[model samples]
Target: MQKGKIGVSSDNLFPIIKKFLYSDHDIFLREIVSNAVDATQKLKTLAARGETAVSVENAKVSVSFDAEAKTITVSDNGIGMTAEEVEKYINQIAFSGANEFLDKYKDDANAIIGHFGLGFYSSFMVSHEVEVVTKSYKEGSTAVRWTCDGSPEYTLEEAERAGNGTDIIMHVNEESEEFLDKARLGEILNKYCKFLPIPVVFGKKTEWKEGKEVETEEDNQLNDVAPAWTKKPVDLKDEDYSSFYRQLYPMGEDPLFNIHLNVDYPFELTGILYFPKLKNTIEVQKNKIQLYCNQVFVTDSVEGIVPDFLTLLHGVIDSPDIPLNVSRSYLQSDSNVKKISSHITKKVADRLSQLFKENREEFEKKWDDLKIFIEYGMLSEEKFEEKAKSFFLFKTTDGKYFTLEEYEKLIADSQTDKDNNLIYLYTSNEEEQFTFIQEAKNKGYDVLVMDDVLSTHLINKFEQQYNNKRFVRIDSDVVNNLIRKEDESEHLTVAEREELSPVFQSVCPADNGVNYVVDFKSMGENGQPMVITRNEFMRRMKDMSKLQGGGGMNFYGDLPESLNLVVNTDHPLVKKVLAEKEAALSADLETVNAALAMLKAEQESLEKAKEGKKEEEVAAADNEKLEELQKNISNLEGEKRGKLEAFGKDNKLAKQMVDLALLANGLLKGADLDKFVRRSVELIN
Candidate 1:
């Protein structure tokens, strides 16, 4: 036996390795298994180069535990370290100065272990002592044993071995007794080694025998040596991708579609990304994409690797170029990482565009499930937005789909207003807004079903992208005003507007967080007597606030909804209400208006005389007379409006018209709805 201290500069290295070398002590198994894989791969390379006589068959890494002995062993059938090589690699921890190392890696344990040549030392994290018995693959090379007891001092000696391989034996410390549990170690192996290029055997495969699981003679291989990502895309079938998806997410729903990513130009990247049938909430489905380094699982939080939107996709992304062992902050600044991100976004956009072009029917069929992801990508990645425009679709309320370009052309002639703005009409709920959608369609206009959770944000993006184009919800405005080509001349004069405004306002629901303004429009006397509508800009901002969680726009969301009580003046029912209102309050309003008009004329004449002169240049008596005339005019107008308001309250037809409008818009509810129903019955009778 030969004894010597490790060549590390400090005696503090052992303690640092134990407490700060890995983020999780359980990762010790991953590091050890990874080393074993590296050895096996090297042996294969050497054999391929005619450097060794070893056969490549039955090459595997085996993990087994002896609970009674309180030890765990990971053995590999591959090129093993010779005594001299062990002394050089294991003794000399070739790393930075002690203080520099601690300062750099004190916060990130995995950085220290993965970046430094300390994969084997990580064994000390969960072990009291570690032993390495290795036999070199070179001919006539004798096997050697290395032992260390969590200290700088280690012993090397000659040992008897049957074949060229390596075995690491770990004496589990009392604090890490969990590592001795077979199930616990098996889980760790499954997480880290499930996709490694080597077959990892954990223990004997179990089968149900006599109603209880029992170990069978077959070995339980915990990993697949060649995952689908390592194979050529031409050799894969749809079902093959599906099977791989199931392997990655055992309990997840089957994906809607798969994009086999294989790129090898600027940087090498290979993996399968699947479009999941996501839930309504994006946050719930985020961080599903697993990142891998050479098939070794690194993390599921792949935000830095994939674009922010693509994180919703679930599957594996294996990139050897991505730094496997580094802090997340380091990854954010990696140029290769940024390139990979851009490449992935491009690939996803290309796949979607291809799918749309090849089989638009199929793409449209899956659109409901795929829309959220595409919208998210378009909103997040600028390049993706530019590419996605060709494939992203807008589904009409009539169950037809069209690309934005196609839809714009289809509606440009009919939906463009006099102001040259193209109106893209949409509805959130087809059933609730059925009347409004039908009205839009009745006017030879197409309405889109913009019902996705991201639709509000997405349409905002679209309006910015397409000049003079705006998206308006179907219920946001009256059908005529939604895409007005030429305004219809007002069929009602000012006197008519004054008489009907109070009649409609009186019946409008108060304290409902809605502001209703009465307006008159001509609709060929065939349109509905009344229609309730909201302003597009305010409604959109409020809807966006709800979707995006306010974000300082809560004022719009919290303010009462402003609605338009559009009373069609051409309708016969409204004409009857106008006539009745005029008859009921005509005498009172005329008398008040005569006095108000005379006072207003006197007040106007006095103000016109003082227009260009200073206050002192004008007569003080004239100013006093103007003020008295203004007060008298205000009093008479108040009396005139009060009579109209009284007539509005007593008129049930006016209230019925207002309630019908509210009911059509699905806004009348509770006591108002109940009253409308009862009044509707009485009016019918």
Candidate 2:
């Protein structure tokens, strides 16, 4: 027997492998099993070419655990290695520079997994010593046994009378005794080898006989040799897909749909992607989709392999093209992964489009559930955005479904402004915005309820895609201003406006966290006295910034909410308030107006003669006369706004209207809300 140091130039290889790799130590099982599978596959290829003597009809890989001997043995019926093959492959360390080897793979998990021809060496990670007993299927080959401790030294000798293939035994290490546990071994098997192409047996089937679990005579295979994804899509039924889903996730609800992805041209990719019922926000549910390489389990963390949105799906993806590696950082940059991601997105969009075209009624039934996924794709991927335009839906307040074009046509005649820009009105809450909805419906305009968190983002997307179209929240503005044909207002004289400002200002709450600018509009007598509304652009920007992004929020949130306190001056109640204020402050305002008219006439005469004069001449002319007129006018307006505030403070009707408007906007809360309710009761009584 002869042995040589592992062909590494430096002694630093062992420590690097132990520490940097300790994080992914569990991958050792996958590597060993994969190597076994590779050997087995090679035997099959040889047999297909008439190279083997043994009848290769059926070959299996068996894994056995011995608690008493503290050992784990993997026996595979594959192309066993001869003594010379072991000497060349196992005895010589293959003096290759370890740095160049490790440099060749900066982050590929597959490279370090079985590198340096170290498929069998992984057993040493968990075991203090490892033994390999082999009988090659080659003609005139002798059986051999190889042993190695956790070091560079190894021994090879003639030994076992094994059938064919190899048996690798690992003596459990002190630091890794946990792998000796039956349950632990079973868990590792289930995690990394549950869907192998060949049968992989772990132990015997257990039975609850004599009040205890006893090992049954039958073998307990731990895998489905022919998983659903491996079969032809035509050969499977809905129940089969459902069963496979159950097998993948025993506790999950039934998936809404499944897309069987089998592509070979651009890159080999096979999987069953299930659209699970995501009733709430997308939470990270790990181990939902198991990745496989040539039917050998690799890992469940497919974030790099699949798109971010696809993580919400649950199923299996097996590809021989994906090399089994140790570093995920390398796979993330793999060109093939991007191809796979695009293909999956297209396939998903195609599936939804097909479903909608084939059975629209069923698609409509699931639209509410399906909207989130389609919306996410549209917002994230530009390509998906293009495809989703065809199948995307718009729903109306009247419980009608319409495509974007259809909805545009339905609202075009009535909702379009003078500039021909179409307006799509929607509400976040049907109950809270009921009054606004009614007002819109009163004018023969439809409102769509958009309550999703992504609705703001989706609206932004819609405006970008649809020409001369805008999405407006139902309660954004009053009925007339929403789709303004013209700004037609009946002007009030300065004296008249000064009289009515106080009656409404008196009732408005000072502590409410909104700014109100009062406006007297001459609507029909039937209209409400006051309507509170906010600008749509400011409101939506503030909203979307809270989600999709976190920028410009301080700017928006810190700014006082701009609400228009529209007082319908034509309403009889408003007219009555003006008359009452005039009756109350007539004497004071009359005296001030008379004094102000005389002063204003003198100033206008003085200004009319100096319109084209130089600044010095105007300044010289404006001496004592200008100072006195300015002081008098300022004092009058100051007294007037103060009186208006005073009147607004005492006028319960005015306060009630302001609060009512706040309540309508869902902003009346806490003590202010309490006062509104109390005032509401008093008014009702």
Candidate 3:
């Protein structure tokens, strides 16, 4: 026997391993099983080169628990270490510079283990003592044993003969006796080593024997040695890819389609990416891409490796290039990750393009379910945005699908505005915006169904991508104004327009934060008395702000909602209103307007001299003179508005007109809606 001290520079290493080396003590099993896998893979490489004579086939890794000995051992048949290799690898604790490295990587230990080669020391986390009994594959080799007891000193000695492999025996600590439990060890093995190259045998298979469960003689292989991702693209059928998906996610629904990535150029990458039926855009999740190094699962949190948008996809991404230690902090740079991202994006777009070309009707049928993904791709990834427009689809309110070019051709002559801008009218809620859709349809215009969460951002992106083109919500304005063929002259004068606004404003429901704008449009004198529409720009901005991580829900959201209330002077309701006003208060409005005009001139005259004046000099003259004019104007306008509001409150025509508009837009709710319906019956009667 040979006894010597550990060759680590720091004596506090074992204590560090016990306390801080691994965040979770349970990961010690992963380190052990991974080391066994490495040794096995190296043996295969050696056998392929004809360097060793021992039979390499049927080599397996076994994790067994012995309750009597209170030890769990990882045994492998591979190129085991000789006495010298054991002394070098086991004696020298190749720890990362903890004092400096730990501070930099306090948040994540990804680089720590991979950079410092601390795979072996992870055993110390759960073991009170660890022993490595190994024999080299070289001919006529003697077996050796190296032992350490959570300390700097260790013993190396000649041991009893064993096969050409390593046996790592960990004496389970009192605090961590969970490792000695067969069920617990099996779980860790299944989690970390389910797809390792070599067969991992934990225990005998079980079966029902004479109406009781019993262990079978057959050895259970706990891994699929060749996962589907490891297979060549031409070698696999569609069924094979799908079966593998079920293997990875046992209960998930069948995928829509998949992309087989086999890239060896710029950087080594291989994997299968699946497009799942992601119904809700808000429910789209990240880390669905399971990243693997060789056949071993590295992590599922592949946020940095794939683009933020592509994380919505589900499948396996096997790449030797992706480096992750025990703690998985993604460390790839923007370039390598960008390459992977661009590659995946291109592959997905190409696959969709291929599918569309192969079967047009089938593609169209799936567009409703797949639209959100394509739209998100177009909006979030610029490269995809450029490539996707050709294959991207637009589904009209009538349920017909069209590509950008196809849709443009379909609506080019009819929906084009006066400036020749292609106006794409769309409705969020087809049922709620039924009036707007009917009006659009009546004018021989097509309205698209843009109702998804991604639609708000996507239309904005589309407008930017297609210059001289704009997307307008179907209910954003009155039908005539929405397409805006040519601006029709308003029948009412400016003074008459201002006069009617206060009347409708009084009857409109103020809660739900609604505010109104009164505008005049000549609707051939027969249109509805009032029509309400949302401001498209602000509405879209608010929608997009929610999608792109609503920073403060209060900011843009707190402002009172705006609606356009259009009045047709030729309509009977407004005509009746005008006659009533002429009989009641037109003379009063003229008097108030004249007084306000005089007061505004006096106020403007007073503030003009104070433009460049100092504060004291400005205050020296007529500050109150300007204030008096403002107060007097405010009083006159208030009086005029009050009289109009009182008239609007008393007038059934005004309330019915605004309520009819609100009902058309589906904005009137609860008691107000019922009252509107009740009032409609009374008006008819």
Which candidate has the top score in TM-score? 1
Give the CA lDDT, 0 to 100, for residue 345 in model 3. Answer: 83
Between which residue pairs do clashes occur in model 3?
A: none
- The lDDT, on a scale of 0 to 1, for candidate 2 is 0.75
Tens-place lDDT per residue, model 3, 216-301, is 89887789988888889999999999998898788889988899999988887889999888784656465577877766666677
Better of 1 and 2 by lDDT: 1
| Lowest-sum lDDT 10-residue window in model 2 | 107-116
Q: Which tens-of-lDDT digit does each residue in 1-685 have in candidate 1?
A: 9999989788898888777656676878887887787678667766766777898688889999999999999999888879998897788885422224346434431112233467778899899999999999988989999999988899999998899899999999999998899889988898888988878998899999899999999999989878998899999998899899888888989888888889888788999999988765565765478777777777777877887888888888987678744221124448898888888888888899888889888999999888888889888888998998888888997789998789989998998889899998899999989988998999999999988788888888888877899888898767777887886677777976776687778878888777888888776577888888788788888888887677788888888888888888779998898888777777877777787778878788888888999989988899889888878877777777777888888889888888888887778899888988898899889
The residue ranges of model 3 lying beyond 4 angstroms of the native Cα positions read 16-25, 67-69, 94-117, 210-212, 324-330, 334-338, 552-554, 584-637
Shift of residue 375 alpha carbon in model 2, Å: 1.4
The weakest ten consecutive residues by lDDT in model 1 span 105-114
Predicted structure 1, TM vs. truth: 0.90
Q: What are the TM-scores, per candidate, against the unseen true structure? A: 0.90, 0.88, 0.87
For residue 572, what is the lDDT in candidate 1? 97
In terms of TM-score, how similar is model 2 to the real structure? 0.88
Q: Rank by TM-score, descending?
A: 1, 2, 3
